[model samples]
Each structure stands twice: as C-alpha cells, then as structure tokens.
Target: MLGYIARRLGAGIVLALLVTFITFALLSTSFHDVALTILGPAATPDVTADLIASRGWDRPLLVQYGDWLIHALQGDFGESVYTSLPVAASVLQRLVVTLSIIVPALLLTVVISTFLGVWSASRGGIVDRIAQGISLIGYVVPGLLLAIGLVVVLAVQLKWLPATGYTPFTEDPAAWARSITIPVIVLTIGGVANLAAQVRGRMIDELRRDYVRTLRTRGVSTGAIVIRHALRNAGGPALTVLSLEFIQMLGGALIIENVFALPGYGSFAFNASLQGDIPVIMGIAAFGVLLVTVVNLLTDLANGWLNPKARVH
Candidate 1:
C-alpha cells in the first residue's frame, strides 16, 4: 500500500509539472506585453518597457519558465503586475475565504445527497421517481443561472439573505453565513444531484447482487441488510464520484463566485486573465493543477482501500 501511494504521489507531481510547463508556454507565446496590459495606457513606454524587463519576458521561454518554477517552489508566487503585491499572499488570503464557504457547502451536499439517495432507493415508487426528477433538474441547470435565480428569489424578492458579497467570519459569524448561504446553496445543488444519482445507481445495483439475495433468503432484517451489507459495498463508487465532484467544485466555482461577488481564486484568475497578468494566471493554473492531481491520487488510494482485490494486480 505504501509503495502504491508513493508511486501515485510521484505521478501526481510529474503531472503538475507538465501542467505548469504547458501554462507557461501558452502564456508566454500568447501575451507578449502582459505587463503593459496590467499597467494600462496611462503608463509611459519606458515604464512599460522597464516593467517587462523586470519580469524577464525578453529571456528565452525555457529560462522564464525555470525562474517561475523556482519562485513557485520557494513559495513566492511572484508579484501581481496589477497590484504590486505578492501573488501568493493575495491568493492565499482569498483561498481561505473560499474554503470557508466551500467546505460547509460540500459537507451539506454529502449529507443531503446521501440521505436522499438512500431513502429514495429504499422505496420503489413515486418517491423514488420524484427524487430522480429533482436530481435531473439540479444536474441540468447551469450554476450561474441557478445562482442568479437564487439571488432574485431569496435575496431580492424574499429578502431572506444578502444578494452578493462576503462578510468575514471574525466580524460576525452569523452575518458571514447569511451572506454566503445562497451561494452555497447554489453551488451544492449540482453536486448533491450528481452524488445522489451515483449513490442511488450503486445502491440499486448492490441490492440486486446475489449476496443481497442470500441475505434476504436468510430472512435478514431489511434495515441491517441495507445499512451494513449493501451500503458498504455501494460506498466505493459513491466516494469516487464525490471526490471527483469536490475537486471540480474548486475549479467550477468561478461562475458562481462572479454571480455572488465572492472574492476567490476563481475571480482572481478570471481578472488576471482579462488583464493579462501572466504570472498570476500561471500561478493560479498551477495551483489548480496541483489540487486536481492530489485529489485524483487520493481517490485512487481510497478505491484501493475500498476494494483491495481490484488493486491486487
């Protein structure tokens, strides 16, 4: 198990490096005057040239990429060309805020979806059908549209929550929850729906297996059979889907963040791209790549633990 984990970690590191190189190459080739874009038209030509020179854009692409990698390894994400602040610091501050929102939202999603999926699967009638229908709607609706709709109904018309903006938890925990509640609801809807569907499908399959039939033949209690026997077997696939969705949520929160006016890595990356802050953009991309690689590696390890026979080869 340790060897397998070590190999997966090594592979994840290699994949992250590849992602960094690709992002660096693309940004270098596509944006010749990244510093100029950040400085705007008011800056003098000489000042812009000096900014470019300082960023070492005139150097060969490989040299620039190497410098960026070295700085990144040292926890120096480079200074934002637009704000003149360290990119790592700016991103980290925002990341904490984003995680505060996402973590609770993810937990809520897992609890709600797991219960709904199990309850629906246990019943084989209209309740199941309705649950399926709700899941479909949640899956089909785009996150941005759902966020806007939530703001309109819950924040504007009903005045139940803040429309958009973040309040620090230190200031007022209640207010922070109130401000982000709607966005969290919007963000979790899709994840819950997807997880519910996956869970329900797995449960259904597990219930039909020969072991379940044998349990039924032995007159095993339905609750015990479902909870202990079936659900445990179903957990492997459900966990896989959940982990993938959680990772996707980190990247996919951009549109929802914009709609809710939350300052997060997604918003930061978006603005950086629009302003051509190549260093910041690349840093964000690298961070995302690292997150995804780590998540996938963990997922693989989890699957191995859940079904050791499958990993025996």
Candidate 2:
C-alpha cells in the first residue's frame, strides 16, 4: 500500500510539473507586456524598461521561472500584480467560496444519480425510458443556458431561492444552503443525468452476469443481489465519473459564479488572466495542478477499493 501510494504521488508530481510548465509557457507567450499593464500607456519606453528590469521581467524566461518556482516552493507566490494582494491569500479565500457550493452539489449529484441509476436499471420499462430521456435532455443542454433558465423560473418567477450571491455556511447554515441551492442544482443536473446513465448501464450489465443468475437460483432476493453484489461491482465506474464531474465543477464554476456574483477562484482566475497578473495566474495554475492530482489519486484509490482484483500498482 505504501509503495502504491508512493508511485501515485510520484506520477502526480510529474503531471503537476508538466501542467505548471505549460501554464507558465502560455502566460509568457500570450501576455508578454506585464510591464506595460503595470506602468500604463502614458509611460515612456525607459520607464517601462526600468519597471521590467526591477521586476526581473527582463531576465531570461528560464531564470524567471526558476525564481518563481523557488519562491512558490517556500509558499511565497508574491503579491498580485493587479490588486497588490498576496496571491495565496486571495486564491485561498476564493477557493473556500467555490467549495462552499461545489461540495454540496457534488454530494447531491452522487446520491441522486446513484439512486436514479439503480432504480432505472432495476425497474425497466417506463422508469428506464424516462430516465434515458431526461439524461439525453440534460446532457444536450448547455450549462449556462440551463442555469439562466433555472434562475429565471426558480428565482425570478417564483422567488424560491436567491438568484445570486453566496452566504457563508459557518455564519448561517440555512441561508448558505438557500443562497447556493439554485447554483448547486444548476451545476449538478447534467452530472447527475450523465452519471445516472453510466450507472444504469453498469448495473444492468452486472444484473445479467452469470453470478447474478446463480445467486437467483440460490433463492437470493432481488434487492440483496442488486444492492450487495451488483451495486458494488458497478460502483467503480460511477465513482470515476463522480470524481471527474467534481473536478469539472471545481474548474467550471466560473460561469455560474460570474452569473450569480459569487466570489470564487474561477472569477479570480478570470480577472487575473485578463489583467496579466502573473503572480495570481501562476498561483492559480499551481493550485489547479495540485487539485487535479489529489482528486485523481482519490479516484484511483476508490476504484481500487471497489475492485479488490484491481491493484493500485
């Protein structure tokens, strides 16, 4: 187990390095005028040159990357070029806000999708047909459009929940849930539908296997066979989907957040990139690599646990 974990960590580190490198490369190539953004259009050539030199932007790309990486390793991401705030503090605060919504939405998605999937698979005919139809519709609709439509109906027309803004769960749990309810529902609808389809397929396949028939011949109940035997076997893939969707929600929350006026990492990244805030952008990129690596490792661990025969190594 220790060896397997070590290997996973090693691979994660390598992947994270590659992602950070790519992010740095893209930012360097695309936004080469950090000095101009900092000094403004009215600044003379000498002024921009001096500013760039002072900021070490005039150094070789590799040298600059080395300096940044060294500082980042020591938890020094530097101050944001745009806002002058510490990059880590700014990013971490927004990340918390993003999680306040995404974490609940993820749990809801898994529970809802799992139950629906198992039901549709166990009870065919109308149940399966309806589930499939709903899945298709949800999968086909764009997230932003769905969010807007939901907001217009649920918030604007009915006033069931707030249309925008996030309240802290620590401060007021009920209000927090209410504030995030609409966005969570919007974020989860497609994931739940898609995962339900996958789970349904897996469950159906497991139900038809010879062991399921043997269990039936031994007088095992349908519920026992489905829940105890089939569900476990079918769960590995569903778990994978859930993990992937969670990551997507984490990264994709930007659009929903912007529409809803939630302060989050997505919005931070958006503004940072737009303003060529190298420190914040680099910080976000590094944080992204870490987040992806950790989530993926968790997924692998889950998959391995679900399938005893599937060793982590």
* Candidate 2 lDDT over residue span 133-222, tens digit each: 877766889889998998999999999988888888788999888888888888778788778888999999999999999999999999
TM-score of each: 0.91, 0.95
Q: Write the per-residue lDDT of candidate 1 for residues 205-268, one digit (tens) a residue.
A: 9888999889999999889988898887787888788888877788777876788888987888
> TM-score for model 2?
0.95
Q: Report the lDDT of model 1 for residue 286.
A: 77
Residue 116, candidate 2: alpha-carbon lDDT: 83
